[model samples]
Target: MTEHATAVAALTPAIADGPQTIKVIISGGFAAVYRDMLPEFERSTGISVETGSGASEGAGPKTIRHQLANGTKADVVILSREGLHKLNEDGRIRAGSEAGLATAPLAAAVRTGSRKPDIGNDVALRKALIDAGQVVAPSSTSGQYVRDKVFPRLNLPDTVRLTLEARGTEAAEALRAGKANLSIGPTSELVQESGIEVVGLLPPDLQLVQTFTAAIVSDAQAPEAAKRLIDFLSLDSDILLAAIKRAGMERPRG
Candidate 1:
């Protein structure tokens, strides 16, 4: 049998055994592809999905780590490797149940119809940041990289503004609302939003290709169904992975 079929067959029993719904809390890093492929997973396994959004890496209440600690119900949690590592360290993820989902590089975007800046090189990217009065970013892994690492390298003046939002899509919204001149986050999240124009990946030296991962939460209510969900996402199915690539993310690299 084909790999995909074999994977699906393993989960068929769960559908008959009892409840078939699995709760998932995911960050935007993997949300694009997940949303794209979810219907097929449900069709194959007869499992229903209930999903919500969270941030992958941040101290805020929106982070998966924080929510899980606060008694959020999630059979599966999708987030950055950094956040997963933290969950793992804290024993929040079920041991040996993690699967890598996809990777996406940080990118810049401006409100559609705005002047696009040249950020192809380090110097040009620096100037672009300065030229734009304020740059908006999310509180995810990519934003932390910019706030913690990239800005220090540029050493721009205090006059440059930085507006941070709780999520990547919100950062895009900030740009669309004229709250900032540019937004930065995973390419997969912002590139698909209307009224947003992606400038491109950050200059090579400053680029971060964040790995998004999926794992069963330790307190998952539907462990078997959650495993099946992870299988469908990571089985390397061309139809889904191709859609992921077309949506501005790369297949996850081990």
Candidate 2:
């Protein structure tokens, strides 16, 4: 067998037999990438993944401070560096298990037929947000990044209105319903929405390049399976990796 096949064989001994179902809680920005790859992952490994993505409130709390404050459970966690660090500090996950998964720049999306606006600069971004009647963003790391950093830098605090504070898919849904004129969140979140058009990524100079990290929970029921899922998600050769990039996200790296 080829070296790659040999490696797979070596890892198979750790695979549990009863069910390949892995319960995972993913947040921050990587959730979209994982969700997109689920079907392919299942087809290849016969493993099932149950995933839920959200902001601080959805995941646990606004900061790792809250995730630690209120105990949350899952086989795996995918969140921002800050969030992961808090989890690590609280002993929620293994110290070294945390690894950078992907980097996504904040992006903007408008309704498919609406006039696409320029968010290339702080001024334009502020105008875009203000112009929109309503906006959707999570209270997660990304939301915090925008609320805490970008908005202040742009000087558009009073102009934009936050319509909803949901997590993951819910943020996208807000955009779809016309409840919000624009959806300002991670690229992964914007890309998953079928009803809206992704205008473009926030300019590099002002971009919040969020680095998402994944960690195996401290006492997972299927630690081996969880590790495999993490490995599969992190694999460079996996088509899902490409899909993540296609969705405008950087691939996970050690």
Candidate 3:
């Protein structure tokens, strides 16, 4: 039997007779891989996945934590590890269900046809950011990383513009509109924008290898199914790696 077939067989003891769907609330980080792999998961396990999108971290109702607090129903959540930590702090996630899915390196982008920023080294990236004048980043973990670490380490003066976008799409939109000269976010998110072209990942010193995690909600409607879904995502295999690569992500590093 194939590896997928064996895993499905092992996971099937809990599956019921009829149609079953598990509602999932996920931030942008894991959505691409999840969306790409969901159909196969469903086909193998006879489980339907209902997905919802939100930022992993931010100050508004659009964040996963905010939605969960405001009574957004979900069995599972997929979001940045930082956001998952918050959910755990809030006592919203089931104990010990957290699983790391994949990690993506922070990337930089410029408007289509614009000059690609020099990101060959830490010094080059710092100079690029300074020369660009303004940078737009999503108001999620990646944005927070920029605010707390990347910007400060580079000593970008307050005069250099910085804006927190609500989502990667918004950050990319800002570049497309020429409102900003650069954007920094996960490669997965940046690749989705058609009006922008990625320059390259941030220099190694400034990179944020954001890990996307999956966990069952504390009040999940289908806890077993949630566990199964998380397992499907977390377990490494040829197919899973292929899906992650397709989404511009990779297996989480130790």
Model 3 quality (TM-score) = 0.93
Residue 79 lDDT, candidate 1, scale 0-100: 91
Clashes of each: 0, 1, 0
Estimate, for each residue in 1-254, the C-alpha lDDT of model 3 and write its tens digit: 44854585686467564557899998888787888778877887777888988899988988999999999999999999999999999999999898899989999999989988789898899888988998999999999999889998988877688899988788889989989999999998888679999899888878889899999999998887778788888777788788788768998777
lDDT of 1 by residue, 1-254 (tens): 44564666765455557548899999988887888888777776678999988998788798888899898899999999998999999889999998887888888998899899999988988899999979999987888888888888989788778877888878888899998998888898886789999998898999999889999999898898898888788876667768788778887654
Best by TM-score: 1
- Ranking the candidates on TM-score from highest down gives 1, 3, 2
Report the Cα lDDT for residue 126, model 1. 88
Candidate 1 vs 3: which has more lDDT? 3
Which residue pairs show backbone clashes in model 2? Answer: 101-252
Off by over 4 Å in 2: 1-13, 16-20, 56-72, 252-254
Every model's TM-score: 0.94, 0.82, 0.93
Residue 79 deviation, candidate 3, in Å? Answer: 0.4
TM-score of candidate 2 on Cα atoms, chains taken together = 0.82
Cα deviation at 76, candidate 3, in Å, is: 0.5
- Candidate 2 structure quality by residue, lDDT tens digits, 1-254: 33322344455555757457777777757766777766766666666788755353334454444544566557877788777766676777865676677888888888788899998876777788888857777777777777777767776656577754757576777777878898888887777668788998887777877788778888777777777777766656556567778767886444
